[model samples]
Target: MAHFPVNHPARPLYRVLSGLIGLYILVFGVYGVAETWGDGLFSREDTSALGLRTNLAFSLVSVIFGAFLIIGASRRGNLGHYMNLTAGAVFLVTGILMMSVLQTQVNILNFSMATVIVSLLFGLILLATGLYDKVGTEEHAEEERRRREHPIAEAHR
Candidate 1:
């Protein structure tokens, strides 16, 4: 026989974090797009030094990826959850590296600090949500075991 289960405590927190990250991605991507549009693609230094075209190409790609994250989180699908989390970590690392490079090129303390703060917040959220899920799963399993062992006493009318 098949049985239905109640929501695990971890599930809600995971979904909430997933949704927040999705929104974060979309907002950041949009800002990037606007900045690139006005600034003529990549920063002059980035383009000239690394031969990297940080143009509309990157913004468009980021927008598309962000959209996917939003849809996945909205649907509460398996793949979307994992992808969003992975993307969060990637964003944190990439932001740090980019900020480090940019700091050397430009004396913008505020900009570098903002980037680091955003990355730290996003990474921390992802890490917290992941650990919550793991702990919640184990707790749920233990509760189930206790229920099974003390069936009648734990059962509600």
Candidate 2:
């Protein structure tokens, strides 16, 4: 089984980081929407927002995802853990998928290389945050620490 740290010492920092990312995404989406208001949903016209290429469809999706991440970061339980994990996976998959269609007509998100890079980066950060942000009691944390330090002994028990 995967061992995610419980009651991690740096949980607050991770939460803050996630929240900041959410804020950036939200702002970027709003800016993108403003810049591409009259464009088609999947407009192929070169439109950039906050150093990332975007279209109406992508901007709307970003708004939704950014809000979801912000809500997840504010949660104080395992819901945040699960939300972060899901968001991370979605970002990673979206990055890879968009990269694959970068030069094709199917690039509906208008993703530039920079946009793909940001998506992958955010995915990794969120994944790490989820792995270490599990909320638990001190006793659970102690047991997790002990198991990590003495895997063989723990497995034998």
Candidate 3:
């Protein structure tokens, strides 16, 4: 049998960061569901995170999001880029909404001051991670160097 080489300079960082985010969201959602046993997905009850007031719907969304991120990060595609970008934008908007008076009208995630802060911070991080690949040509040059250096191993394989 033979195996092909997969040279992705950004994959390591992408997997690490996305995996962490996925784990966090998945665990948070699972805990939320556990705390709200019989309640429906769209329940108005608070999440397991005390005083957060975020509902079950948000928890479900979190679970889905986490799963997607894991899948995206595990594969060699543009999933990470899109997922991070989308999540960053959405969370940023959610934070902005939390800070605004419309929070009550769309209290999907129990937009509090702390939530706003955390959301903004995470959003920025994701945004940065998503855009990391495009910042410079250094990564590309490094990848090329690795490829050239390992040509012998690749041929022997």
Candidate 4:
């Protein structure tokens, strides 16, 4: 059996961010479904067009991904290893689509603001997670080097 290093303090931070993402997704899905229902079963202009289907699909996918993130974080799984990057890419693509292709003729502010905020959060998470992983790798490498070079100085029975 191989022993891995102790969990880094940054691990908790990663988990917290994952939880936040989960909350965002869950809330978005719940709100989206409720709004559609509250609006007389998708009778609005947006719904009648195609926004309803797109929003619902996006919300469902988000909910599923968010749940996985939360579960993986709780179990200390390696989900965080790629989740941040994947999420960031997803947000970037969606943001571009929302700003360009899905731009509404009226009430553009709200749409732009929401997309921008989500995109920025994704970017931040990606950067932070990537940096943490790099730092941990460097620390582990340094530890290994020290162990190899100063073995006799800290000899064990």
Listed in order, each prediction's TM-score against the native is 0.56, 0.94, 0.67, 0.58
Off by over 4 Å in 1: 1-7, 44-62, 105-111, 131-157
lDDT of 2 by residue, 21-103 (tens): 88899999999999999999999899999999999999999999889989999999988889888988999999999999999
Q: At residue 98, give the lDDT of candidate 4.
A: 60
Off by over 4 Å in 2: 149-156
Per-residue lDDT for 79 in model 4? 56
Clashes of 3: 0
- lDDT per model, in order? 0.55, 0.93, 0.65, 0.53
Q: Which candidate ranks first by lDDT, i.e. highest? A: 2
Candidate 3, residues 89-157: lDDT per residue as tens digits?
887887787688434655655455776786788678777666643322556556556667998875776
lDDT of 2 at 40: 99
**What is the per-residue lDDT of model 1 for residues 19-125, given as tens digits with 9 covering 90 to 100?**
77767656666766665666544344232101222444455555776676667556543454455557667767766766777546442222345555665677667
Leading candidate by TM-score: 2
